[model samples]
Target: MKGTAILFQADQSVTFIEDIEHSVYEEIKSQCGCEHCNCKIENKIVDFGTVSPVFWHEDEIDWDYGY
Candidate 1:
């Protein structure tokens, strides 16, 4: 089965939490992984109380476990 894919490009100049979170989230979810399945963005949230936002793709995550 085809899995979801994620793509991200960080804007180092961005300082606002909302902008950063939304920018990163949008970039990741916008990734077109497979043409076989109809894709959708599952969840996107920003928690200021935590260090960073949690990220995951619908498919098996490779490269880094906690990037």
Candidate 2:
């Protein structure tokens, strides 16, 4: 619980993450997501936005994230 965490919501937006224990991050990654989540890992439905699946699929919406 001594690291940073980035929580990706189902709405395709980040939660402006806080001090979340690393276990929580690992837990979320181990589950299969529902309809609201447009993510798939290992041919299974997982939470999207964790890795930003929207731009990955080309949803016709322009996603411009410049660093």
Candidate 3:
């Protein structure tokens, strides 16, 4: 079984948004080998706002690549 879940961070707090059946979240978590997972079957749904930015660009900016 595979599913997806979303985690939200606001006001210095973390919360689980919702769970979807056989979703991308599950696949990602599984691939990451999450050690603290309880493997519980539960679903959650939340309503929020939707907005899009008007300006965005992709460029190879210099970043601190810790190596």
> How high is the CA lDDT of each candidate model?
0.33, 0.40, 0.32
> Quick one: ranking by lDDT, best first?
2, 1, 3
Q: Using alpha carbons, what is the TM-score of model 2?
A: 0.36
Q: What TM-score fits each model?
A: 0.20, 0.36, 0.22
Model 2 C-alpha lDDT per residue in residues 1-67, reported as the tens digit of each score: 4333344555666542234445444555454253443333345664444332221111222237641
Model 3, stretches more than 4 Å misplaced? 4-6, 17-19, 22-45, 48-67
Say which prediction, candidate 1 or candidate 2, comes out ahead on TM-score.
2
lDDT score, candidate 2, position 26: 57
* Candidate 2 lDDT (Cα, 0 to 1): 0.40
Model 1 per-residue lDDT at 12: 20
Number of the top-ranking candidate, with TM-score as the measure: 2
Clashes by residue pair, model 3 = 2-22, 3-23, 3-26, 4-25
| Worst 10-residue lDDT window, candidate 3 | 48-57
Off by over 4 Å in 2: 35-67
lDDT pick, better of 1 and 3:
1
What is the C-alpha RMSD, rounded to one decimal, of candidate 3?
13.4
lDDT of 3 by residue, 1-67 (tens): 3222443322333333233444434433453323333333444332222211111112222337641
